[model samples]
Target: MNLQAVLAINAIGIGIIVFVLSLLRRQRLHIGYGALWIGASVLGMLVVSAPPVFRLVTRVIPTSLPFQAVVVMALSFIFIVLIYFSVQLSALLRRVTDIAQHIGISELEAKSQAPERNPVEVEKRGE
Candidate 1:
């Protein structure tokens, strides 16, 4: 890659790292997610800044275009993030189901304890 292009990619990577850090500091981003983004950005910067790293990636990716390598890296990152979120979503869904089940059980128990009143009687009382 050209020096200018490498510099620009490095700058973008640095910007992403800084942005992720700021989000983490402000508690607007989850620590795990922030770390993931920071890690990816740092890796990107390393790949862009170092000739050896580029050579290694090129060997694996076999792409003449740096942009193509970047796109592959980005797609991999997206896939990883999607998997992580899917796991988190599955856990949350399980938790919500458990909570709802507990609530239902509690309501049933409460109803079993309380005296049964006729609906007509309750309506008359309301009137």
Candidate 2:
């Protein structure tokens, strides 16, 4: 009935969809770390949005603290998830470059191994 409840329920639904789709596709998800992000997002939404849960906490924890803590915690979760993927992306890019370089070097080595084809000797013979 309330806005928060709506949001939380929607978030849970969306998370489940994403998880199912990604898993079914055998998706090589962004650096192989999407599960934690989805889990955190779903759990955080559910915890924050539920009225009864907050009602209980408001008794001991300062009234304002719950809101403040939730905001901070949600932000932290988002930032952490972003950073994890960013690091993974960077690592993947580095590996791609390293592989490319390795392939280039192998190609060069292969070129050099051709029979009867030393550039310097060929030059001298030509003269």
Candidate 3:
């Protein structure tokens, strides 16, 4: 299949699906991710679709291997970065959950031992 054809088809399908999901859902983060996916897909297509760009890179690098190796390397870097960020995000969420649980426990303890108000004192204060 032609690269241009694939790019156009995917761009439309992916963009429409993401737009629909964004409209139907309230999750800004998910929407942002979908947008990022769409952007990256389009960018990837643009970069990889042309033969001249590949030729230019091959000339500049003077590599026996094709430019696809470079593309793979770039993808590996992206995957590594994604994994690192995901781990960091998971750790941050765990800390937040711990803090929330601690706060809930503290609040419950405070409420359980709270002193009761006296009716007599209330009446005297009202008088």
**Which is the leading candidate under lDDT?**
1
For candidate 3, give the lDDT: 0.65
> How much is the lDDT of residue 27 in candidate 1?
99
Q: Please, what is the TM-score per model? A: 0.78, 0.60, 0.48
Superposed Cα deviation of residue 2, candidate 1 (Å) = 1.1
- Cα lDDT tens digits for candidate 2, 9-64: 56775866587557747865643355565666666666666767655545545545
Candidate 1 Cα outliers beyond 4 Å, as residue runs: 111-127
**Per-prediction backbone clash count:** 0, 0, 0
lDDT winner between 2 and 3, please give it. Answer: 2
Worst 10 residues of 1 by lDDT: 62-71
The Cα local distance difference test for each model comes to 0.87, 0.68, 0.65
Highest TM-score among the candidates is held by which one? 1
Q: What TM-score would you give candidate 2 relative to the actual structure?
A: 0.60
Question: Model 1 residue 3 lDDT?
Answer: 89
